[model samples]
Target: MVKDQLTQIYTQNELSCMATYSIKAVYHKLMGEQSAVTWDKIVWNRLSIPKHRFILWLAMQSKLQTTAKLAQYGISQSDMCLICADAKEDHKHLFFACSYSKECLKQFKEWTSITSASTDLQQLIRNIQNGRRSKFQKQILLVGLAALVYLVWNSRNSSYWQQSIPSVNYVVKHLKAHTKARIWAVLPKKLSTKDYQWFNEL
Candidate 1:
């Protein structure tokens, strides 16, 4: 099938003469194009840690292997949440719906002054993307949210493997310190003075 497609392309392009062999043109012709997703910016933000971005990518697609997913495959014995133990351990419950994750998000919001009232992960990301904050502030919020998601998932894994979860305080503290340090390390050269001051104040 691939050979037939290549033969068609060659014949259509009339490669009998001196034809320029552009790999990019051939690749694009073969692969075609795909529409961009709304969360692309949130997941691929330059300010976010690479590992955090990877986890957020999986999470935005609901691809994380939570207990509920494991249970679907007869891998886990129960679908109960490992962190909260009061709900099914799916992507939604493990994000901000769980008590442990809720406190972490609340503290993060209080620290960052994020006013969005949404608890759903995707909705919160959309709020940040469309909020009336400065570009730098939006980037910070998105990166911080990604870090929170990564840490929350990490805490859930800790509970599953070690039978203990990190405290909410611990998670929030780690989130603040790690995210702040990460942004500080990669501060953009074009950052406005006001945004720099605001970041320093945070």
Candidate 2:
């Protein structure tokens, strides 16, 4: 049923790929040799992950990291969404199209003046490589995104293991901090501590 709905929503080729197997297999099979590695590929590889596992891992990481009330270390389906409190914990709501994440993207676009392609993860990856940003800027953004993803994952682990709520502000702060450490130089500061705190309180 879900596959049929996805097929109707997307093109035949997209439907076929999305339905054939796991998203990772689809990504590797179709995207492995696309000539140009997109922002998604760059970000995924930066995390030292294989292509297919990266997709699922990223999505899961985003949600699991933010949730503070779930048990510290077990795989279960009872976790609740930390942001909206209206849904179960899941990947889709944690990353691309979540309401809170959308707000975060909105702030990102306004600050960077870089328009994201779409809320769809696949499209984000596809469009990021082809966007009009400079190579330097693209690399910076890619690194920032990668850091943010990893930080979010780490924050989730902290919440689960340490019984602490890792706020979005901490996530963003750690992202900037780690990015700076990695780049080893001063870069333009995009998001602020106030912004991070506000996002957490939202």
- Number of the top candidate by TM-score? 1
* lDDT, candidate 1, 132-171, per-residue tens: 9998899999989999999999999999899998998899
Query: Any residue pairs clashing in model 1, and if so which?
Result: none
Tell me each candidate's TM-score.
0.83, 0.51
* lDDT (Cα, 0-100) at 41 in candidate 1: 74
lDDT of 2 by residue, 70-90 (tens): 534454545666555566555
TM-score, cand. 1: 0.83
* Model 2 pairs whose backbones collide: 24-52, 65-156
Q: For candidate 2, give the lDDT.
A: 0.52
